[model samples]
Target: MIVAIKYPNGQPYHDSTHQPLSKKAADSKPVQHGHRGMSLEQELNRANEFYLQRGIANIHKKPTPIQIVHVDYPKRAAAKITEAYFQQASTTDYNGIYQGHYLDFDAKETNSPTAFPLNNLHQHQVTHLLDTKRLGGISFLIIRFTKYQETYCVPIDAINQFWERRKTERQSIPYQAIVQHGVLIQPSLYPSLPYLEAVDHII
Candidate 1:
């Protein structure tokens, strides 16, 4: 029989491990929500900015890129570009050095109570994460169970299982499975992701 487990905080789990497991790993990137004056993404970006200002740590979302196709030699010191194209993202959303450790992670969100879709993840991200792990870097995924208003820190080892089981449509990791292997996190204004706390528990 498939057993159900619940954490003390009232979240459900898959079994004894307490990390949520699903077929899909990281699904669509999660966007911040519900700040009247600002978009959720804007609010979180501001929070990230504030954290950077406080010198608590240096972590920033990866920047968007634009390709240059045409240029005009306008001056001796400057050139003007006439054509450009937006470039696809090459890495996970957020990454940087924290507490002398190299940190790499991505944020994803799903409204599903049962699963966090694997469709949210990309092949390149899996490759990047694998490389980081080999180099002794701290690599993980940040998942937001939007329905429950809960977030979790999922490690790569658990993530790899979903990667290995890629032959089926059961892609997204269910919230119950997440509760099995992942560490629950409650983000706050001051600390933002509060990943360090989760990292402490995980390592």
Candidate 2:
């Protein structure tokens, strides 16, 4: 019995019983999805600048507090931050006065198709937003679905309800649920996200 091993394509090795195997066809190239290169933060910053320029609002992203541990002063130039750590966890991304109300919110981006994972939010962040709401501030979340290029302004009340329900229900909030409860925001030429237009509708 001339037992033999061969390639999956039945191509065999040397001894004249062998024949070179034709190469397999390469896999088809994947389709590339177009994406906006600007980040949520950058868009919000641009929007805030436009708001400021038009005297419509005075919103700004909160700067993270960093404790400088060491600094290298290369004389004649600016001192370089050699070592530093965040002083404290920042509460929210942006906050300021709009009209006669106080606004507080955090911007988030997700690529999830079915849902926005609550994991994107922190316990403290939730608490801060809720507390802001309690203190008569308009607290909300500016969330963007990167895959869909859609943004929404979700009021803290709706988020709080979801957070409270998640303890005994689904861990993530479905995109449809957000669509039902949140205000859809369109990106524009001036204010990139135009979140305030949604805010105006809500407030």
C-alpha-based local distance difference test score of model 2: 0.80
Model 1 off-target regions past 4 Å?
1-44, 71-82, 189-192
On residues 166-193, what C-alpha lDDT tens digit does candidate 1 reach at each position? 7664767878889999998766533244
Each model's total of backbone clashes: 30, 0
Badly placed stretches (over 4 Å) of model 2 are 1-35, 87-90
Candidate RMSDs in order: 16.4, 18.5
Q: Give the least accurate 10-residue stretch of model 1, judged by summed lDDT.
A: 17-26
lDDT at 203, model 1 = 55
* Predicted structure 1: lDDT: 0.69
Per-residue accuracy of model 2 over 1-203 as CA lDDT, tens digit each: 78555545545544541121122311243223222577888778767766776688999998888999999977555556789998767588789999989999999889997888998988889999999999999999988888888999999899888888887998888999899999999766444477899999778
What is the TM-score of candidate 2?
0.79
Q: Given candidate 2, what's the lDDT at residue 160?
A: 82
Reference-based lDDT, each prediction: 0.69, 0.80
